[model samples]
Target: MLADGGSRGLLRKTFGELGLLSLSAFLFAFSFPSFISVDGLWPLVFIALIPIVPVIHRCSWAAAPFYGAFYGFLSYAVFNYWLTTFHPLAIFIVPVIYAVYFLILFPALKAVDLFFPRYAYWIQAVVWVGYEYLRTQGFLGYPYGNLGYALYKVLPLIQISELTGVWGVSFLIALIGFFLGHALLFTFEYDASFFVSLKVWFSRRKAALAVCSVLLVGTLIFGFVVMRGSYDDQRPWKVALIQHNADTWKGGLPTYRRNLRTMIALSDRALAADEPEAVIWSETAFVPGVDWHSRYRTDSERYALVEELRNYLADKSVPFILGNDDGQKADPGLPPVLSDGRLNRVDYNAVLLYENGKLRQTYRKTHLVPFTEHFPYKKLFPGFYQLLVDHNYHFWEKGTEYTVFETDNGVHFSTPICFEDVFGYLSRRFVRNGADVIVNLTNDSWSGSVAAQMQHMGMAVFRAVELRRSVIRSSNSGMTCTINPDGRLTGMLEPFAEDYYIGSVPIYAERNTLYYHWGDWFPLVMLSLGLVLLLVGGVRKIVLRKS
Candidate 1:
């Protein structure tokens, strides 16, 4: 399999280009919150894609996909460096998926640049938004690194999220990136001094100005007006969010016992400080499967622990919400168990609501973390599934329904377990289905990275504005906080710390939020527009060639 001299030369050139482009991605990665600075170097975002533009424009159609994948992997790998902490395999797996995505995107960017040089950047922005929409769909959808997430603190700019979800903000930001990127390309095209090329770029700014100005000004105007309106805490319900600071990866009776005690201590202190209407605990705050152990009594020790939890729940005056493993027997009609003569049982990562000393309702997590949490389709991806299984990955069966919980005082809400809050559609659905607030129960203590925690919380901010629903994030060990409808995060507790937050979570007056009714129409529109432009470009190219 040794390559000849010519092939080796090509390989060397390719690796050299890849190494160079990764430096650009690294520069852009600092635009998001990280160890570089918690409040990211936001100004860099406007020019982050400057280096990417020239490559796509110069590369041939045959070479575009390869470069696209190269860009995807490097950009994501640097931005999501925390994936390595999650699992050694995750850093590669997550970015490689993006690589496959950019294979389509990169070629299209090049094709559009070749055919329609004048409006290439504008169309490219639309295409980028479309790609983000595609990436955040299906089982593999992780809406973490979208351009909109970087501007979480920029209230005026992100106000567009109400009408267009995060897609609109992404489109605006991406357009800016492309506009600035094209300016750098202009310098090379002119073969002139940098200052002279800069002046020329500014003079020919009609397209970018026309699009960016109207959106930018209108966004700020809307934001200021909206911000001025008082968000009345008229329908307020106090909730105590408990962060026990537990390492979720560690399992067994000892760890479980310690985490539970910490949660109780925090909850008691919160109750003492303020009489919260209810208490919220992070995901898997209790490790033992409550329903399964109480019913079947699989292990005597775990069963005893479940009994203790039941007694604690019974004594609580107000409703208590916590995350646990909800286990049930698998159907005989399903595929044979991976177990060798073991109990044919399936477990769900679920949030349970207890009132009057009884389990009232349960919401099983719908969106599972791809390979780590749930990996089905064994026949199609046998090797990958086996690889995951070999790594000791325990998969959970996907839950089909969205469950809404109601407290004794008639406070209606839904708990979107863990990363579920990061997805816009889930929060919209919860609000649509009569959930007054969105409460997220998450356990991210295992990552051991504050940057990772901040990244997760940053994405959740958009869900609040998109649906106009108050969002409460209660996590084990960090990022426990509440977000208002206007996207202002309040009471954001320290990451990876044992703490509790009691907040007056608002229940907005039931009114039709535009995004809730429209769903993901904005992104769909962008995707359609991108397809149409590419189709037009193909037709134009063929017509010109034939003539």
Candidate 2:
């Protein structure tokens, strides 16, 4: 009877702890993009992980990984719910892969607690940032939900990204979560006078508090100073962003023609009103590939379609940057054929610039999306590659160079197609290559989710702030807008709306951001520090065991 009672008690306690962990996961999800419309609720991110911290601290090392994985799976499943819109399988696969990150993180935190007991909170925070840095690396490095993105609307707080990238902001947020969690743990668990417990916790963690305060204050001061600095030499380039709310998937050729006509009519109206320097179109704005402009020049029907577009551009007398599939004849030296057994040609998702009916520049999309766009490690697994091919899944070959285009007026810009703009380093490379502005051409009609579009825009805003460059994003279905150097949205078009916006984007010639010069160095340093600590901890444990 006594043994049964003890087992039941232990089971009840375990369930209670799991409940707290679940609450933390829920709060963490709610603090991110989709769940909360109000950006002011971002402060909830600081305390969201507090509940899980206690669970992690109290659980045995063997159990910590499971708890962390469960927490991560639940949190990510909720935060990235839009992934299901792409495929139902994503709900299972993505969370399972993402949970491995937390599984590793929790054990590292336990090691920190065991090795550096006095500064466990600080070490835990470092480990958190280190894990986040790791998440942004390797074959499947996705830089989503980095906590800093929650503060996108808080312009002043995010200017620090210029110096430290998103990792620094994530480090600050993790530090606050650690501090709050530690304080809460002391308040609840300490079996002393409440005030005494408070004083003891404060004394023990004063160094962490001091460091966090300095970083927070310094970041804000730096932000304000940068914001106050005048852009007296800044030149405004008026741009017309066209969003033709087209259902590219279900839409046949007739629908495509109608959408194209609508976009052309809208562009004409916008040009008549403002006469912008250049007009931009979303990804794959038309059906015909750039190759058809020359490849099918002999075919009257195909040639006429290409001629119609060229004539329109010539009539407008304005330069245009638009998306198209540009193709090149495959090298005969290459061995393996495509799934269709045709290796005659290779196609690229490219952005082409046209001035007075002549193609001036073509920038192919690099950093293709994994699996769906370009399968990683396919050479090693030929069977899996064949399987994908059997399913009729066609992937675009990755582009090699960072291509930047210059307008006749001497304005320089780079077009990063689709979610390529989400990568800070890729955008930084363009800025380094003398791109004054980023023109992103994307087609977001597939997901058909407003939250997904807004979430993507939220991340893209950071790219503008990180490099102190303007970003003009034109999407097929939504989020067509101009973002200034300060991350402010201007002339934003409504989601799923057939609309066009004309706005002036400030061109900053100076590209001296620390992030641009030294990409992601802060996170790399943190990751290195974490590795050193783990090595030291492992050495100490081995020495003690031998002794």
Candidate 3:
């Protein structure tokens, strides 16, 4: 009986320690979102200071790994809770995979701290930022839910990203975390003689406080100046985004007639209130198939449907754009079998621009989704390809070139479908090639949870800030909105419901962001500096051992 009681007590203590470990980690990561929100500046940076207080107390290097693990689990669990929908196993599995970053982060941090005792915490903090920068780049880069993304709602602070990308804004937040950590540690007492004890150090603490005050003043001044200089009066055009909250599962031919009617009604309402020069609809709003009026038993049925759309726009006299599937007879052959000995070949997903009831331009989606839209091993594994096709997951051939649609209003816009807009370099290519604005058509209905919608929108804000261009995003199942050049959500529609809102997307033509001009070279430079510090620490350790 005593043994059982002892076992329970031990378990309780272990759980208590773990809970503190989690809380300590949470303090460092939790306030990250507020850093980029409409919330004011100083509090976001203040929370970054708390984690270092425990580390500086006795400096137990073992706590670093525990801190890392706790922080990683909390961050991923909160942000990526939607991964469960992709596969039932992902709820536990995704967090385990993401935890590797923290597992690597802390041990490396403790090693740097042990080698460079004078500024070990600062050095570790800087290296931490370098690790974050690396994770968000490269071909396998998944930059979703970064700490900087929490600040997406904070316009004035994020304006600096125009010069440095999201990595730059992340670096600034990291710097604040490290500085606050240092100041907290600076407040501690020293173990020495009466002359060199904390009583005297308390007097010297005033100097440290003064230095921190100066840093605070400098950051505010720099942020204010940058915010003021970011806006340009010489901009280009205004775009209108139409968000039809449609469900992907219910988005087949069965609901085609109803979907068309709802969208037309919304467009008429928008045109009535605030007539935006250009209007856009979400992805896959129209499903194209080979039935071709055979089901209706009339040759003019297909033509009539298109004519209905044309007549509606002509009546209002406004240009319209929407997503549709484009497929045509592949070769010069008989009805069923073409020259390729297959059925009618469909050209994947495309955006159709209708101006004055005439088709003006068509831009096909270039980057296909990895597993959902296109299978990676189609040629190697024919059976897998057959499974994907049979499942009706529309895998389209990727477009070879970037197509910028020219509007009658003299504005050129580029289309980024779904996750394609999340890439910094890809978004850069469009703006660099003379695109006035970036339009995103995404369908988030497959993601049933709110976290997935917010995470996706978070990535979109970073692109707008980095490019210094306006973004009009139209999404299925909510989060449809427009972002100004500085990454503010100028207008937004609610998610997971059937609704539409009209708002003007002011187009800006600034091509002078340092990030746009130079790419990720600056962040790479900071990373190189961290690598040098790591190398120097290793060499110093070797020298000390030899001595």
Leading candidate by TM-score:
1
- Backbone clash count, each prediction separately: 1, 0, 3
Candidate 3 wrongly placed segments (more than 4 Å): 1-17, 24-71, 85-93, 181-216, 229-238, 289-317, 325-349, 366-371, 374-397, 449-451
Whichever of 2 and 3 has more TM-score, that candidate is 2
Best-to-worst TM-score order: 1, 2, 3
Ranked candidates, highest lDDT first: 1, 2, 3
> What is the lDDT, from 0 to 100, of the residue 72 in candidate 3?
70
Across 1-547, the per-residue lDDT of candidate 3 in tens digits comes to 9999999986775565456446544554344432232122334444554454345333345655665666677766655656666655445645665577776676676677567765654565567668877876543356665556757666666766777787766665665565555444555444566445545544655664465466546545655776565444655454556666666447454476677787877776777777578778788776543123222212354456655666676654466778776554444354634557566554557777778866787777777765556666888989877866775666776766777888776778888877888777778888888887888888877767555776678778888888878888888776788887767787787777676666666567745688889887756877787789888888999999999
Clash pairs, candidate 3, are 33-150, 36-151, 36-154
> In model 1, how large is the Cα lDDT of residue 399?
86
Show model 1 residue runs off by greater than 4 Å: 1-20, 332-341
Write the residue-wise lDDT of candidate 2 on 6-111 in tens digits: 9998898788778988898777776766745523257778888788667777888788888779878888898788788776655776788878888888888878
Model 2: residues with Cα > 4 Å off, grouped in runs: 38-40, 193-196, 297-304, 332-343, 379-394, 545-547
- Model 2 scores a TM of 0.92
**What is the C-alpha local distance difference test score of each model?**
0.84, 0.81, 0.66
List, residue by residue over 2-115, the lDDT tens digit for candidate 1.
568889978776776676567668767888887797777777776777677888876667888988888888888888888787788999998898889888888888887887
